[model samples]
Target: MKLTAASIATLPPRKLPYPDSLLPGLALYVGAKRRTWLLRYRSGGGKQVHDKIGYFIPNAPEGSESLGLAAAREKAREILGRVEAGVPVAEAPIHHPKTGGETVEQSLDKYEKYRTRQGGRIKSLPKTMKALRSALADYATLPVANFTRRDLRRAAEVIADRGSVHAASAFLRYAGPWLKWLVERELIETNFARDVSKPAAVKKRKRVLSDEEIRLVWTAAGSMEGVRRDAAKNYGRAVQLLMLTGQRLDEVISLKYGDILDGKWRLKGEHNKSGRDHVVTFSKTALKIIGTGEADQRVFPGVHGKISGFSRLKKDLDKLSATSGWRLHDLRRTLFTRLVEDLDFPEEIAHAVCNHKQQGLSAVYNQASRERQKAKAWEAWDDRLRVILATEKVVTLAKPLTGLN
Candidate 1:
């Protein structure tokens, strides 16, 4: 029998059955606000399922005795008309996975697999997935089908409550792609977290160090204990290169012996965000840092257990920065700012040293392999660094290493 006003009133909150001829497939009653209702409907065999269609607001003429009841009837009639014509309807509203909910996790796993298989240069993939795992570890055992937006908001609150804006941002960012994917795949009804805003980027308020500050930091870092000492060595070399060559730390640290072909360091897509190869010519300081290592050797090798992480490295620097007063990355920025601000190095050559893939057609066509000019540029930089280091006597951090580690 067709679901009518009196019939719906007598029915329970959920699983209120309706006639297939009048409606279509199974209709399961969900929630309501007096007369308005949210329902679940499924089409075909078990292939297609939808959660919510539209609200059942009481469409009363003038006044009605039972507003909610009258509205339910009208809404039912409209939904039934659409179903009978075989139009697809919402099965459920897409929501954030609840505490102990795996809904978003499932979506994310599939997305990751697709991306990996597609062979994209996802250098940050591991970091992104690690954040997702950490955020949803507690909800791992929960069913994927029961995720809701309320749950997601609560999770974000919990993370923010713990005073971790960075962590919260990480979780939210990782969840975003998966949420969009679910919406596209019709996994949930709609993406509730789609409108969720992300945290603002940490400002790069830091600038390159002045000559006086550079001496102080170099002196302090070189005088420290253990890995920071070696990190200081790498730091020394990297700083000199940065000053001379003007490359970012990420691009410089990833440099290997093999990449140095005919006096050029070639950074592959695997090491960079830009899917193009970059060529950086080493300065005399950069070459000295290279120091006769095997072709595949890393320019800077951390000790047995020092994590290859910026945060970890930052903490180490913070402790030393008290005496040195120079933030670690400022070394790179110092090089950039000095070249651009003080020395007036061409912006193209400055960016080229960092292996920054420029934007638009210019980035593609204006690729100048200025290895000769770069070499000359870096030679000038080496002389500058030597003058600073010798004058300041800044290489005695910790016990003096007879040879580079």
Candidate 2:
């Protein structure tokens, strides 16, 4: 029988003999207190299922009423429409597993955060990310699995053509691991980075500063002017600190006032490039250069973080010193060279000052720390720098062994 308001009310609590003819699968479900409409049908998968449409009543009172025969038929028709379209229309929406969905940009962002959680230094990763994004701009929206070996080779070639073999190599170093991580998670079948060209060859830089260059840089640092004078001053001091301590640029810039204690700068393991704690004795001049800052605050504060505006400051330093073809890292090499050659400091003591890791059996057996010896060496280095700053005449020194010979 066709379902109608009059027919549905008189229907006893007994089970329906058959479904209504008006709507094929629509039926009035009689219960102890209330009546309800249930639509039963097979889905596209050929499995039978039932869905509750709405409550029914003999007489609808005022604004709220029972689900009438017309309403039940309409709702059933809508659900059947969804089923015919290959959707599983049930009481609740079905959730399916995501497949090949994440884009390259999305994966890269997630990988960056993962590295941070794993205690990896993210200082230089952004450059690599930016380069990759620019090179793979066409593939930003493509799924991570869609990236191919050809993509990696093309990106490396693009970066290398810009005249930085080191940056090209750095791109592979940063991107390769993240792609491998995706493979480990089963997001992709394989790492295309493995099939790409290996990191480009890099010529080790040997651009030590001469005494005349140091003197010129020291004077130039003090004489910075114009709108960016304050930024230049901070970068200049950081450069000088790199010269005095031979520490990594990031470690020196990230120094807090609390790191200074008992005439030593205590560098935490997480902040050091070697992933080990380091303590360096500061000279009187070094202390003066550091000056005073809030105990919990950065020793060299910048607009974004500690000590920025590096490229501009470096250009100015180069112009004033009449120098070319030197980077900030050369300052560290200059200090290590000066300690071993000019000051007659032992090679082992110099390595300790630079926090270089030992090799072979020496790494495990040699626990001998020459803190006092390293302190004296720093004092001697400070004395030498002061003498260079005091005079325009270039101080000549005996050529140091490059170890290449």
Candidate 3:
């Protein structure tokens, strides 16, 4: 029977075949629920093959036809034309032409484009790709298919030899997934970086700044001069917020004015590192440091994007404070440590303060979120910061952190 929109819509669900009268080889296979349009054709060698044209979806919104009768017949004609032209049938269903002589740079570009199309938008993808290209500069122009285990190992070795084990590790982390992506797409035969041993573990940083050092850095954050003064002050405020909240530097810097609402900094799961919602209560000290900005403006605007140029600001901070070898991340650890050692927060409360996920048994059984306790803890921490900042010692409930003028 010749199919129409009404006939296709009224077709009952069954494992039945509907042959198109207009196109000899085009047919629809109606399985339990889905009906897929397929082109039944023969290769030059006369081997019969069935190629999926599209799905026969009924009542699709206008302009989004997957496989209407007219379109399916047109697609079947195109497939048959290609078959008649001696185009070999693809061995794999999801076949893409192999880039046998394609360079690493080209492969990276294709990889990025593929990922973006697949909705895998990673913020660090560009920087990571650039770093990997730098590490493999000697072989970047070489064909991706020609890379072996030795080439990947050599890349790691060269990065390690430059006195950055972390960089070497990061190179492997970026390369492994990228090479695997190529392998999955049949651009390369093997993912050589997959089995390569990771570089030796570097010593973990334990350089927590002392209270005096913290005070020095805090004060120095304001005294920066020339064109960098504003940027420095911005970094200093970010540092203060990090210390007060025990959140990551990126989280603080990426904070939009909208994130501060209802007397708390609210981060949805997508914005948080833990992939869970996080709410940080504001304190008087935090409010003072956040200051006033437009509702759409960033709390700390520095450089091109959210509060960059930390390394340059850190140099000035280091020089003025006469403190060395401290990282911004260490401030998170410092807050956790002080919360326990100085403020007498319980171990679990300290962990909660840092937003670390509770592990094992506690995570499953403990349903209470301790929101009130957290508020009290932040209040205590803010009071301590006021003492350090030499502001009024009283800790009060904070209004909206952004008094945007």
Candidate 4:
């Protein structure tokens, strides 16, 4: 019978192979665990070979490891062509001795554990693993030994075609190091992903919202409405806090009332990107926005954890504020720039306010929080921001807007 996707879905598990009438030598075997596609053909040596093509999915999408009926047929034809030409073909279900017969997905699991033990960035591991999984989805079930440079290139191309060259490049960055680790452990003979050309480098964003743009965004965030009004308000408050404190978005959104004490917000090492405890003194305006909350409760409570749906929230915010080409991170950048450029605050104080990591000998010895200096900077910023928000006309400065300090 013709092997249709619907027919394949209902096929019962049996010891016998169900042959496909449409594709010569192509068959499906429905085992208790999985349905797999196979090609049965006679080799040049007159030996009958049962070549396993791949597993079968009723309707597998593009880039899936599992093959649909159409994809299976195509693979079967390719194998048969090689068989006819007397060319050697690698058998499916490859078991490499060095890798202990582990698949790509299995190796990735081991890699994650190894990296964690080696002191990999705790906060970034999940995101890196997630990107690698997505980029290598088509090869997840294949043995690590079977992965080739061609396969890495194909995976990157797939991601690039989907519209994010930056994501494609990032995939290579993550995968290359992991593949190299496999090589060092003798799991694979070579790092196949090492030489894959990445997409062009993305330009670093230098966008900083002007005072007028800041005011517009601040006003629009406060006046948000509709079904997601509460969530929107929470996100808006987080944005405003980012602008006020020059703190990272994740740090702001993940804030808990317990972290704040005596008008100073403290961030634990694990909760921040720097992996060092950070403390920032809050201005009166920032404190009012945070208000009073239970010690354990989140300042901006999300449905699950920290507030999400940022892309949608940002789109709505852009529409409402009449702002474009600016990111939430730009708020943090704007704060730092305004502090140093307009307010004449020293660069070191601005760095303290942003909790930027120091370098060289200073990084090892300097443990000072610089609380007094940071508080003074925040006070000056608060005054400047209030003036910007209150004015109806856009304030254009001919030179540095100094003297607030």
Candidate 5:
């Protein structure tokens, strides 16, 4: 009358759509479509009538029918058997709030916490959560498991309507991972979202500006409106470094006075993305931009309000670009390309300034802590930058082309 693991394994295939499990009087069924696996368990408190245990699946190759029916009855038995044996599953692993009702907001909150635990980038987390929040507004009332591609597409449409294929794409990307996780944990069947396409380009268009544009922007900065002032200043510097030194935006912004030593900018343990010390050589321009002998909390602290204000910088830059016809990110792109193509900086050195790990031995085997030579490279870049900046001028719409010419 009691079930044994061997007994369950030995049972005959009941029909075309077979019940894979047998607990004496109980039955566990795998679907004919092979869509789902179900385990029928007899209630400890009740009669011969059976109740469903749960689901599980072996990970299968993508796009295979195996994944569709991946959750098998025996796997459910292991989990239920463990719980039944008085091994308490963690009080709340992932989403565990027992609720008469659940909302998308609640699930997303749980997911955000899980992501933080996984060491997902904190700066990116807020942006990711903001997108999820926007997506959930129209769909929050619906069950997360019940969400369909149409629903996802509708969310995508809304993002696209906001003129952002990128945000729409990112939402779908993050959503799929969370949905797949739910599938893996037996919180759901195969993730319906496993097939959704977000379609972002593998390589982003570098948005850094050309030497000419840099000159145009610098000339444009002084005469720009109040809102554009901060943006032009921060981005001007950021763009300069991005082109000149190849430092990431954050690395450039996170610089503290103490971090600079011997005319070099040193990234401390707190700020380096690589989680290692990074030394940025003081190119004459980098030094001139950052090296006011007077100590302050930050070099670009000239922006109004908000200490270490990146958003303010972005806001101002956006305002200026709307009028002047340029975007701040373009500056970084222009810089990366110039370093790679024009200045003859090695690909690895260019990537190093961005704090991107150099690939292959440059990234993995070499474990190089390139300090001295990198400094020289940036300094050389600075020397060239002065020549470029000195040559061109940014002109405003109010003034004719002849003014700059």
Candidate 6:
């Protein structure tokens, strides 16, 4: 039904929005204490946007702030015209109440508070906010309203140059939503970061460590010493555990004595990337390295919570090991590759041992735990690693063991 003044007056407060018959995108949001006018439309990038037009006042005099039904339709049309002309609703010359010229840094603080109020369930929120502040440090004092697309692009470029394309991409990925949040609150005129082009994709890394490199790393990790000797040794042990178990870096470091039972490391859903409980059988060597501990005790505690000073420790490891161009994650890829190629283990079993989620139809129907197969594969890989370490002479292969093409 077309919204008339009388009809709107009779309309009760509803949880769902009420659409206007005359205007396609115009709607009325009836709340218990107030009513609002909203204009819903799609952006040029196919993103759906609900632009708040204004509040509704039943019997306000002419030139009042609150818009009536007829006035709201007119306002919606005006906004729609600008939007259709390639201007974002945020960028349109609409008068919104100022947020007292909040600076980017202040806005960031507010955003953090907002996320905290929402329960802060996102594990990476803190890191993401830190990166944003670091990337946009130059604009910290600048008002959020003045932050532009060019500025956001420049920030991304700076991050890419200083770090990696991946880092820049991550910054943009977080910034876009944050800018949109500012726009939603009428604090900014536009979500300038939304349309900024991401840095060109970098080649995916496939670096897998060779047997000789693995031996070097193991030896170097064991020999690490400095002022923080105990912490360094703990980090080294954690690195070795990564090689042995093929688990993610975060999951391995987060290991507690309670997580290990009966020669198996049981990872809770929260700790696992797949958000499901996973069990990985431990080799005798891995168990020995883990040693004994109370159920509540951390196996490898660092100065704070878990291992820290990764960059310095990794640099030392690289120098001592005399190996370059490989990451800790490479150890996982190396294990999976060796299991499948050298031992002729089934890909499915290898995947299970790695705790990789299945793909396609297999993910939908294949609920088999494959625990027995995973255990067998783990034992075989453990034996292979022992052999690789025991050999005194490094067998020079005809081809380099960099990665599979």
Candidate maximizing lDDT: 4
lDDT of 2: 0.73
lDDT of 1 at 151: 52
Please provide, for model 6 over 287-405, each residue's C-alpha lDDT reduced to its tens digit, 9 standing for 90 to 100: 88899899988898887778777887787777767787898888889989999999999888878878886678987788877777888888888889899889887633222121110
Q: Name the runs in model 2 displaced over 4 angstroms.
A: 1-99, 120-135, 192-195, 198-200, 226-229, 357-369, 392-405
lDDT of 5 by residue, 1-405 (tens): 223333433334355334443423234443422223344443444333334333222222222122122233444556467556756433322222122244466677888888788773454576678878877576665555545566666676677778777777788876786677667755557776656666444346545566666655554443333343354454446545555666666556655676677887766544455655677777776666675644556664435522244455444543444344445555555655676787798877766665664455555566676676576566666666677877736533334211110
TM-score of 5: 0.60
Q: CA shift at 62, candidate 1, in angstroms? A: 43
Poorest lDDT segment (10 consecutive residues) of candidate 2: 396-405
Question: How big is the positional error of residue 280 in model 6, measured in Å on the Cα after superposition?
Answer: 2.1
* Tens-digit lDDT string for candidate 3 (1-405): 667766875676666578888778888877765677877888898888888777765544222334577777877887788889997546435322222368777888888887667653364666787897798777665666656677788789888998889999889988888988988978778887768887787788876767666677666654544354366567767877887888988778887787787678876655555545567888887888887766888888775667666776676667666778888889888888888888999978877777776678876777666667777888998888667767433322222112111
By summed lDDT, the worst window of 10 consecutive residues in model 1 runs over 57-66
List per-prediction Cα lDDT, in the order shown: 0.56, 0.73, 0.72, 0.80, 0.55, 0.78
Ranking by lDDT: 4, 6, 2, 3, 1, 5
TM-score of each model, in listed order? 0.61, 0.67, 0.65, 0.71, 0.60, 0.66
Worst ten in a row by lDDT for model 5: 60-69
lDDT of 6 at 383: 89
Better of 4 and 5 by lDDT: 4
Which has the greatest TM-score? 4
At residue 190, give the lDDT of candidate 3. Answer: 86
- Expressed as tens digits, the lDDT of each residue in 1-405 for candidate 2 is 556657887777766633678778877787666577888889777888877777665533212224567777888899889888977564664222122478778888888778777875565666667766766665566566656566677667777888877777777777778888899978877877767765566888988988877876666655554343355567767777888888878778888888888678986656656545678999998898898777797876665576666786677666765666888888888898999999999898888888887788977787766788989989999999888877857633222112110
